[model samples]
Target: MSALTDNTYRLLRAQVTGATDRIVKLALFETVSEVCRLSLSIDPPTDPLSDFAGWLDDDQWLKNHTLVIAGTLARLYAMPKRPWSDIDTARVNKEQYDTLLSYARADAAEAPNIDPTARLLGSIRSRLPGAKDSQTRLALFDVLQEACQRGRIWTELVPFRLVPGKQVFSIAQPGARIVMLLNAQHSVLGMQALNYSDEKIAVRTDIATLNPADLLYLTMALAPSLGADMENPATWMPGDIFASKYTLLLHGVLGAMMLQTAKPYSNTALGQYHTQIYSRELNAAPLTDRDGGLPTRQRWRFPRFA
Candidate 1:
């Protein structure tokens, strides 16, 4: 048998036999079939075991296909999904945060090709209220990076849920839908400026003359990795109960946004800040809970083909 076929056989055998759970075995089997269909550009067998046997019959085919198979599997593993747990979300967030730090420290002039703001804008343009100038975009990116370094970040998006309520209608009429706001106070921008009277004017601090809330909204639109630092929660908002949770949720949403903008298996180099952030695993400490203490440095690993 060729090396490709041999490797495939080994992987399947190991997975099928090693897994005690039937669910895991079936998932692996389905994944293998999908990868084969993608890499070989052929219709896979209805039976996964039969498909494995067929590959073994063609040594030449296997020899020519090993690399593609390995690469495709690696790419799948690397592709981000809604994280399975808060711990997983925290881990990925830390990785992305470290990448932002590196970009912040790098001399922008040295890397003429890199444009962090453009990449961030590309990911979040759909959410922005209006278009921003190049200078505004760059400034926003800088402020967010600084926020990550200082750990003054708040990460979560505002949460809303839909509910069906009784509506005045004829028989068999459907209920009117209403939105129940949850975590409405989870504002990254903090609070709105109030106009109390004509005689008294309250001037709020502005970034580039943009409203503080607007600037905060724009910063969040880019999905920065750092979330509220529990140790110094005063910056996010003193006595906010859900501050940490909001920060975690923000990182999770940013990760999801990045995945939305990602083009899998692309040949082009990741030159933008947003894209480059996911390009490699960074050596950074995983974020811990408030009582859990400071983060410890650890090495993260991704699949080779990714």
Candidate 2:
């Protein structure tokens, strides 16, 4: 079995115990939700991921999945909402990052191709002499700025996930590691990895120190404790028209909160998971107008430069 399959198998096995499974799943959900909240806070309109570079070294950051998840959450929050059709066409809009764009354009002016993109890249290369080409320089600069912005958003989101997870078993990795552990066990569940990295994984599970199977069980047991609305399954529950709407809304509120709190998968991972979820439930991936189109507008589109 692939490592992923082994992980999934373990998660299902962990779940078979009933109470433990639900508890872990819910706790996992809560940790993910709180991380998303801290990273993508509605208040003050900020993302903490951008600031990570200031406080963390590359090796430290890479091993810190909790912060990574928080960073992902911040990036998701920092994302601008735009029409799906226009996402790729919407570069930095050449307006907000005009200073950088113009600098790039002027640099490439002397190139043989004189590609505007080339010019902009050339401009960057002059300043960053070691850059091999325009694409390299541009990518480095953009990604750096983007990372910085994401770090800042994560700073706010981390506290929520940290406190709650600590209340349980010190959730260090953003929930993605838990997700990774779960999916790894259920390889046949048609699960696809979203966005995960070693640094991101390290924060949640000290893979070096913990047993995979044991950790899976512990994760499952802790899931419930992390939930904002966790309760023992009550004897009687109300059934009403409003209840249905409320349930849907509840999922939305929680899911949105998760997106804001959880780390976002990369575009490729996002697409793969979207396809996986679509295949399973077509309508369950939070893509409705009533969700206020938040899901649709979170990713960046191409055609980034003029």
Candidate 3:
């Protein structure tokens, strides 16, 4: 099984056993909902393979089936909604890193052709004159790989937006919310870095210590805590309170799975989680009426100088 599969299974098992904290529980439930949606997409009427009950009770079944589940989660996690263009850039960064690494490891005659005009590669070439040395080249290759990994995580964590009148909810909404939960986990660990761009909100974190599976679980568990804050009628009214309650219950299970900490769950902690989540979710302008026609006015375009 892949490392992600193994880790995801373990974290899921922990969640099942009530071993995580409250914030994590919230996120886990949300992640599970996403997994269910993916499963439905695979086979809507009778997805026997995606049945949670079949794998939940039996440890062996859970282990055997996790690869598909984990892979789906990872793919969903990596996908970007409309209006978010950075995901493609991250993918390109990964491809470039892989290409550079292969070249660095290969003999000079075996090196692959790389476009000098590529933005990332151009920046590296300009800064490191001696990058031709095998060791230096290899080091540079590693740096790109690391940077790409970070970029991948960043793109995955941020949700894409659509122009007003395009869609009520961004296609990437669920994944973005899930990423918020993960960021909440990072905030607790003192590792989250969130920033806003003109197009979309972006997030970064020190996730080197987190396993893919652990990260997934953390994200899953954090969603509920965030929803609870968002559901407040004074701040943001919930469309369906019953559904929200059900979600909160699922998150409660996730919270139970967390390692016990000295600080108790209090209003302060709740506020902290809420603040972290809203910081990202509320950064963008409010969604305009979906039924409205697209505006005819053309926005100004800036020219780039070569």
What is the per-residue lDDT of model 3 for residues 40-114, given as tens digits with 9 covering 90 to 100? 222222333353343233322222232233333333334455222245444543443333223222312322243
lDDT of each: 0.31, 0.27, 0.29
Question: Order of candidates by lDDT, top first?
Answer: 1, 3, 2
RMSD of each: 22.5, 26.1, 26.4
lDDT of 2 by residue, 17-56 (tens): 3334343333334333343344322232133332223333
Q: Which candidate ranks first by lDDT, i.e. highest?
A: 1
Off by over 4 Å in 2: 1-22, 42-272, 285-306
TM-score, cand. 3 vs. native: 0.17
Quote each prediction's TM-score.
0.20, 0.16, 0.17
Please give the distance, in angstroms, between residue 302's alpha carbon in candidate 1 and its true position after superposition: 43
By summed lDDT, the worst window of 10 consecutive residues in model 2 runs over 216-225
Whole-model alpha-carbon lDDT for candidate 2: 0.27
How large an RMSD does model 2 have? 26.1
Model number with the top TM-score = 1
